[model samples]
Target: HSPYFNGANKSTEVDYVQVYKDVADLLEDNDYDDGSYGPVLVRLAWHASGTYDVDTKTGGSNSASMRFEPEALHGANNGLKVARDLLEPIKAKHPNISYGDLWTLAGVAAIQELGGPTIPWRPGRTDGTSAESCTPDGRLPDATKKQDHIRNIFYRMGFNDQEIVALTGAHALGRCHPDRSGFEGPWSEQPTLFSNEYFKVISEREWIKKELKNGGWQWVDKNNTDVMMLPAEISMFNDKEFRKYFELYAKDQDQFFKDFTNAFAKLTELGVPFKGDEKVYKFETLPVVVT
Candidate 1:
């Protein structure tokens, strides 16, 4: 009887377009970092899904396991509680929606609202009831590590070189917080606006390795000194294969959008068991207001 329901599978019947709008409306706040929760929301979806291991198929956003202990306290997921807590009211509003679907959809909303690509999304993921479904520590990429480590982590999730490069372009959005990641600063000058800037910075800037007061290492742009890159990102420049893709993305924003949409959609869907008939929804982006 309700327009939001087909009365068949309840998960598929919930109006996800409204959910997207709800999440979009909460992305900005003056007190928050760079004035938006968009970046961290993207990270929430990424860490939730990036844990998938192709061999065992044990991890992914399907469980929304990060809400539990161990995974919530994971070092890689540090500071993500802000993103989760921000979405809590939405979860309360849409009681029937799965945490997995809500988080991943929030990610799609963040990207689109921040001027990135439209991510194809759907619902059907069910929440894991307890901490037993949590992924082990170290499933995420370590910023201190090199290209080899990046490959090992992503390869386990079934992404190849190009997809890996496309996914890393997400560094374009958020900054590393000193208290959270033990690193500081953003990869792009405009950290809140999504673009090809992450790759462009890598290609254009001369990065000088700097040791933080926290005893961590990151590369600062030799000229600007404010923007930074983690060692894992610098590895993209050093590795021949990785370099090829980032370089291309630096020159072409359209290509970057296309590849990133595909790779990120794949990342979020990992381990999700969607009934074949569930419709894929592409929510409309909010209109820009010109000054």
Candidate 2:
């Protein structure tokens, strides 16, 4: 009658706090990540949940449909399998947790691991059937598009201009893969840590475009640096409205964290129906103990 086995018997009724603790512990134990798995986990959670369209109420985090063939084969979903596989061990340990909750919790784990803000999370999502999952292609933002294109894509997902800018703040975590997004380099040198560096570099640096080593419409920094920005992200600087929020986020880390956490939480719950309190829970931050 092990607690772990007993816990599986009542999987649907497991406490959110215990689930959070388990995932957080797992993240702490794994040190194989490049910078931090935090950002990539954030990206994974975002990609998993961001597909929902309220109009159709079709796709969302509930199904973990990324496991299914149709969703996995999507163009925007490329490279996400790595993120999914990374969580398999955690899933094995806690068989009671739904993929939807597991994916989103991984995000909370990553953020907390990287010294970012605590993203208040709750769990009531059940495993949805494959028939319940289906978001059209192009729902996710295209890296190569312009500001208007970014607006069109995100807006369709029911995000406003402010939320759109806040959501892109996730670029602070992961980079554009030449093989995946057809874009190259990390958004910042420290892609694993959570910071406003993405906005800082985009606003302060002078970017020169170079031919991509892997081909396609990719561009590298003229300074021969490792950082890269997609056509869509650069449009934030080029467009007045987008730049306004970017500047605000750059100048104030607290403001960016507040907005980003709210937007990301909203993004995760896009298509779900929850009648309980929507209060956000800020988790206790992990301390840095240097040897």
Which parts of model 2 are misplaced by more than 4 Å?
1-11, 26-33, 277-281, 287-289
Query: Stretches of candidate 1 above 4 Å error?
Result: 1-12, 289-291
Model 2 TM-score, all chains together: 0.88
lDDT of 2 by residue, 1-291 (tens): 789997776764545565566656655434544544566678888888888876777677877778877778888888888778878887877777788888987888777777677788877566767744656677787777788988887877788888888888777777777667677778777777787877887887778775766665544456656877787778767899888998998899999899988888888887766668644455665555688
Tens-place lDDT digits, model 1, residues 1-291: 875565556654577889998999888898998999999999999999999999998999999999999999999999999999999999988988999999999999999999999889988799999999999999999989999999999999999999999999999998999889999999988999999999999999998999899877899999999899898888868999999998899999999999999999999999998888888999998777688
Q: Count the backbone clashes (under 3 Å) in each candidate.
A: 0, 0
Counting only residues 3 or more apart in sequence or on different chains, how many pairs clash (N, Cα, C under 3 Å) in candidate 2? 0
Q: Estimate each model's TM-score.
A: 0.95, 0.88
What overall lDDT goes with each candidate model?
0.93, 0.76
lDDT of 2: 0.76
